[model samples]
Target: MSLKVDKASMAFTFKGGMLPMTVMELTSADPERIRDQLAGKLNQSPAFFQHTPVVLSVEKLDEPHLSLERICAVCRAHKLLPVAVRGGAEPVKQSAWALGLGWFPPADGARSRTLEEVPTSDMPEESPAAAAPQAEAGAGRIYRGTVRSGQQVSAPEGDLVIIGAVNAGAEVLAAGSVHVYGALRGRALAGIHGDTRAGIFCRELRAELLSVAGNYKRLEDIDPQLLGTSVQVILSDAQLGITALD
Candidate 1:
């Protein structure tokens, strides 16, 4: 007879998930040049690079040779962890394995779609990260229905206007701003592309998480007085400010 198994007692299980990861597209193969550019970016937005996991994308590089290790080192010095390499030749793939980094096919090599664009019957492996949803004819995207738990809506190009409540475990992200007509009980990330002037406005402020321009405040990190009130979250000089709408 087959033995009964308790799945909950299993020490490990593999599950698929969609996580946000930053892609560092490379145009040049010179490590020094990359270092110089990273230094400038660090100076402009220091918090944006704080131990962020990034994949080095070499699909656009025209050079025949790449100093992959040196580039990874430079990224580490700036607090950017190089977790993987995307799109490279056989030697490049071998080098990545030597460095213990995962390999991804070139963007053009694979016909992948963002999480929102994929249908249930036909889903492809996710790309490095979903390119934030673009604006339609220079205007933001609007959602008319409730965002149920575990669902995500993104308007990475402009503002995201939600006509209904964002349920617990839901998420909303935008490159410009996020405006919720109903209660915002889940997580909201505004200015995810580093737009410092972006803000988050909600009818009810019992959010599990709030972020602007990479600065985030969890529920515990928020002030007690701000809970259950209408509020706007703003980012100024890399600081997050949550103020009442009243």
Candidate 2:
């Protein structure tokens, strides 16, 4: 008689939780240069990039035909795990997949914001840090330029604050909260680590996507009148709440 045995896979429950991830946006096709720069940056801030999970972003490059394998190799050499590739041409994406890489599109029309086109406002002077969302009171990444399409800024430790517009196809993610002093046209995700009190604040509520904690809402779900106006997004009872920030 044969005894039935239960497989270990059946006993495991795969629950999902959010974690901080780093994205290496490649503007050049030179693998050596990238490797060198990354090495230097890592040396300066060893703790920040130590064994960090990285995603390769090649959408902003003039030439997307970079050697995916070489990039991956360099990442592995420096203890950076390359898990996925986002925003590249079809051929480039295909090559990455062949090298055992996953493909992810820019979340909510995410695009890269270049320094050439910046937002200008005639409003009273306010520091970038002051414009940031105040939630868990911790150090947050202060971005000074526009968040363009396919560009993403993530503050894994605390919150994220942008002094300029977040154009369509861009994303700003934070572990605590997100604040934008200008138009928010892309995506903003707060409380990525599941803090229910996380929130999103923007000067102009033109976002295509917004999320607090695990609750999410698309542009269509928001009131049309709220567009292009100051707004705040929060999570209440596992639901997304939008309100004007007076």
Candidate 3:
């Protein structure tokens, strides 16, 4: 006559959200140097840099040395989308605003802490199946480029291939598969049209959120074992699985 009891812990459900933006500091003293850097990078990978969004950081610029207007014009001429300005002096900030660019303070305690300070455990994670279907069959565009933060690429016809890093705060949407040759530290959506067969492949798995069709998966729900040097994401039987690519 013995009594036994069993206890089971409940598994928590989480949703993945937007990845934070990666900062690219431009501290060159000479404007030509900055232009040359951009040109070299673009020349090396035209597809990767074309139409990518970027934030300008001018905190290091000396007074009357370089103007924000000039910087914005240079960025535009190089096909780089200037979306915001950060860590710049007052004049630079004002210039950015006048150029129709968004402005934000540098990542400080009063403003916002850097990504390192923010705990990863607190990030959002959700299943790809839970999202609302935003794509239709054979609807969307295919983009071959490096997706930086403040930039978004969407296709209604096919998949998207990013030859470079999908930095945080950037987004990639496709009606089919998504391939990232570089680190995927941003949000990527595949099978946007409810095609559960679409998948995502990345060289580095550091994305904030991953979604397929209407489902999504968050970071917290991801098993530590699945996070590795390379990863592949797939949806089968309405379930999303992250597995080693190799």
Query: Considering every candidate listed, which one attains the maximal TM-score?
Result: 1
TM-score attained by model 1: 0.56
Candidate 3 Cα RMSD after full superposition onto the native fold (Å): 16.7
Candidate number that wins on TM-score, 2 or 3? 2
lDDT of 2 by residue, 1-246 (tens): 997767764867679975444567787878899889988755433433446567888877766577888888988888888989987778888998898889987543312443323234422245553333423335777776666555567788788888788877677888788989899987788887777888999999988778787677878899998888898898877789999988
Q: Is candidate 1 or candidate 3 better by TM-score?
A: 1
Worst 10 residues of 3 by lDDT: 127-136
Q: Which stretches in model 3 have alpha-carbon errors above 4 Å? A: 1-145
Top lDDT hit: 1
- For 90-202, candidate 1 gives per-residue lDDT tens digits of 88888998999999988743232334554434432232112223235365777655665546777858899887778765778887899998889877888877888999999
Ranking by TM-score: 1, 2, 3
Model 2: lDDT equals: 0.74
Candidate scoring better on lDDT of 2 and 3: 2
| Cα TM-score per model | 0.56, 0.50, 0.45
Please report, as a residue range, the 10-residue window in candidate 1 with the lowest summed lDDT.
123-132
Tell how far residue 219 is off in model 1, in angstroms.
7.6
